[model samples]
Target: MTHQTLPTGSVSPEQAAREQSLVDEVVASFAGAESPRLRELMEALARHVHAFVRETRLTEEEWAAAIEFLTAVGHITDDKRQEFILLSDALGLSMQTITVNNEAVGAATEATVFGPFFVEGAPRIELGGDLAFGAKGQPCWVEGTVTDTEGRPLPGARIEVWEADEDGFYDVQYGDGRTAARAHLFTDDNGAYRFWAVTPTPYPIPHDGPVGQMLQAVGRSPMRASHLHFMVSAEGQRTLVTHIFVAGDDYLTHDSVFGVRDSLVRDFALQPAGTPTPDGRDLGDTEWTRTRFDIVLAPAQTASTS
Candidate 1:
């Protein structure tokens, strides 16, 4: 298509009409998509994107800069480090997408953004076992139960837990094959589960990439709230991906990824150096923290279709 170049400043009626027609042209191009849902999505996406460009009166230089930023995000992504996911998180797109997919169903646990660091095949631990696996941080005793929305216990539910250590670094961030600070365990017949993990601390989302630079440019802090990641799944139940945030984390209100939910926050009670542990494991003179996160899952029919 071709068009006459309009002068800068207010858009005349002719220019606005041309812009709308351009959007219509793009939307029409997707009319023949094989999948009805695909056609709808592409057409809607085209209209919204074109509207944004027209509304912002985006300059050529700005478009070029956006392209460059996305290219950098792609260039830095790999099997382990997902810069694009980071970018989405920083922009709140990840959380928005999660919200759109996971609707609240009764008393079910709310879902949150799935960060880029999750790895498959995390080492399995038995109930009441330790997940630290030598990662450095204050020991935390985490216990919880898995139940359906109706409060019925769901036995043998798989719970995957992962978190950053004292230094705010996930095992994957270390770039070594060694895994720590992450593990999976199954609930007992009563739906009760317990394990030891590092006490979570507030940390920044990984900076030093395009996402980080974008955050800095927008005057936004990359800090995330202190929390432990949990992915719970049971047969015939909708899998829940969420975080249990420490009650008093300073970054709770300003989590860079917008992953916090008031319902998910819980107190991490601190025990004295000589306090007795629930599992009878001796911590010697070291203080420990403990928190519980009883999870309620929706039925499989409530799972996200997207």
Candidate 2:
């Protein structure tokens, strides 16, 4: 009798049946979930994760190493730094979540990552007030209008803005309990707003932790493109978290967090010292940059009651 050899990685019928049985059992465990959505999510998660393990033929040693890496990620996370967000951003999960949650509505502005550095209760600034608060960098004048999808002005919109200084460091990174380069201001009656912010410079995400190690292992850079962050919200509108990338930034194509969007890129025009400013704030012997970012908000999605 001649024996037929199976191809590489092929399992016999009995073994395949055993593997499938395990997956079924795991998925079945979620049947008792109180929420229908929770049950569905847990079951789907179990199936997909099991499929991944089966497809990869993942070894026990590799699973152990992954658990250890995740442990390190949790250990390094703190109020000042979020290692998990870095990991998600590095893996493109953050962007994927944003895409799933933020369906495009007409010409509404696109949304991006709500980076880990955002802090609550930021100081409120009046229109055209400076946001730098003495942080080091070239001065930039940021102006914009907030309007609805129909181009109607949305007055009283709240805009929260933050960015790393020229040296690629947020105020939170200094460990000195200081707040700079971050502020919140409201739109005026005309839905217009402006502020003095430092010109954003490209900077690396926090990469000293396990996420950084993972990126290094895959030969990836942790550099994010130069951009200013914004979180805009108005009554009866969906809140938007996004960034305005500086046009011509070298890292636009390879932003570590995958947060760059073509629509969000804007020109940061350089002005020679002594050029007349719109509001005329004097900067002796210092050149400045300016950019305009118009924001459009989508109508908030209402829950279906039917």
Candidate 3:
């Protein structure tokens, strides 16, 4: 929209202004929406959206392209693919929503965007069991403890873990629904959990749809940081959805999904081969890395119920 300066009293932008005002009145027509909150939200949404179009003087061609882009986004959504969530992550809206909806739960673990790859009903593994089905990355031993905000151990806490492998591919991406590089486990009496899995590596978000074109048009890369995801829950405490990013990953500062946090970044230390694993897994002198992540959960009512 060109801001043309006209001589004072020369001409009035009556047509454009009237169109914007008419849109507002149409929104006002919905003031009788059954729920007060819904009505309020709808009105606000309409006002801002309308204002944006008026302020930008959006072209009909641009609006038509937007409609086509949105249609492609919807067309690509499915049981295994979530194009909408990917879009939200790309726009940083997911992280913004997380920040706003979560209250100060007295120094509990900070939440991050739950990526589009999470799947339910992952096979349960015993303590110290291996989560890698066929991933070929270097072995990584992840150890963690579940504790309450007050530092009390939470025994039997359900800990679900998933991540992409060294090659930057999650199990679900194969489209076979295979269970690998992901598992669900429970904390022991001492509030500790351990598992054998591949080290996480930087990966590109799926970008073969309209999102890919959108990124190309905006000059943005789709690479995400290397990290392992963990979702911890207990009987009476709030669930913690977080990840541990590789401390020195190049993409950590530029994660496409904007899920990285300073507190969540940690070291994945390399250990000499033949070092015995805590779970008594016989690696037969194989080299492996280790990472320890301690999770703190607040009471269910104090935190966002994710």
Best by TM-score: 1
Q: What are the Cα lDDT values of the candidates?
A: 0.90, 0.90, 0.84
Give candidate 2 regions above 4 Å deviation. Answer: 1-9, 302-306
Report the C-alpha lDDT of model 2 over 207-297, residue by residue, as the tens digit.
8899999989998999999999999999999989999999999999999989999999999999999998889899988999999999999
RMSD of 3: 4.2
Q: Each model's RMSD to truth, in Å?
A: 3.2, 4.7, 4.2
Error of 1 at 301 (Å): 0.9
- What's the lDDT for residue 150 in model 2? 94
- lDDT string, candidate 3, 138-208, tens digits: 89989989999899999999998999978888887787867788889999999999889888889999899
- Candidate 2, after superposition: displacement of residue 141 in Å? 0.8
Q: TM-score per candidate, in order?
A: 0.94, 0.93, 0.89
lDDT of 2: 0.90
- Candidate 1 lDDT over 63-134, as tens digits, reads 999999999999999876789888888888999999988888999999998887788999999999898888
